[model samples]
Target: MRKKTTIEILLFSLIICMVLSAVEGSVPILPLDQVKAGMKGKGRSVFQGNRIEEFDVEIIGVLKNVEPKKSIILARLKGGILEEAGVISGMSGSPVYVDGKLIGAVAYSLGTFVKEPIAGITPIGEMMSISEKRKKGPVFSPQVPVKKHLTLDELFMLNKDFFLSKAVFHSEGRALKPLSIPLVFSGFSSYAFEQSRSFFSNLGFNP
Candidate 1:
């Protein structure tokens, strides 16, 4: 009886360790160095009505030094309505996993009306580094002076830095820009919304 009880305790301990290790490995990060071209992965995001959906990702290649000490993973995304809609504006920062390990997030999109849902992924390592920096200190402060009346061009010029950045790539006279975010307006008249639509679009918001 003593021997049997000892054996049972050992088995229980082994099972507990296995469970813990499995939990730890479930969301492991795949390092950028190990990532290669032609890797296939799946990304999760909400396409409609808060329902999380999965999409397929195929790695094209890695863009080295896209920014100083940063890299972007180029990939072609498919599945769901991606082929019809292309990369949706708000799909940025969706986690992409390759070989059951996270590689990066969808952050940049190919030019408008592209034939495919090609995207640029900001690597997990780079994102983690940015998060670490944010924890160190305050990284941004908004101090823009608001003017009561300004023309569309003047408004754009005032926020030019916020509206534009260095393009990720240029193809066929189109620059890879950040995916525009969709904005919903409530309690506004149709005329007001229409009037401001172009202004918001220039600032990367699709109203």
Candidate 2:
């Protein structure tokens, strides 16, 4: 009887450990409907020196249907490095939590020259949905030559669809081309820059 009791206790302990492990791995997300305006939260991001720090988040309100069925969380941030430098460009994907629940990530910047840092939070649900789709789909595979010898007209013809899709037209009818990615070159020759510009430009990238 003692041996059977010992076995039962061991099984119970094992079951408890398994339950705790599952809980730890799963991050409980707060539903968007539950989030209210004027609620306070904390955001985590790496500011400088590779250390992730916390900042204060004051909820303004949720922007519903901003992007065709997708919504965003609008919040005013205070404290941390925001006091000195406003919103850092590389701070995107910084996870935000409200009431100890995961809310979203710091995705959009309101303005550059503004004194206060106001940002748009891409909801955690949206991000998770994106991740799920990516996991289930085949990865993107691009084919490109080592040296692109295509002319400007040829390049334009080949990538016209991409440029058209990315092109943003303002109210004044001015075409605002979106930069695919930002590249920085330090101490590189002007000739090198000019030569590489075609390659990058053909690949729908901004150099």
Q: Cα RMSD to native, each candidate?
A: 17.1, 16.5
Question: In terms of lDDT, which candidate is strongest?
Answer: 1
Give lDDT tens digits, candidate 1, residues 130-192: 445544644222233223333555545543442324455654465567776677878767976
Clashes of each: 0, 0
Q: Model 1: what TM-score?
A: 0.64
Measured by C-alpha RMSD in angstroms, how accurate is candidate 1?
A: 17.1
Model 1 poorest ten-residue lDDT run = 139-148
Candidate 2: worst-modelled 10 consecutive residues by lDDT: 169-178
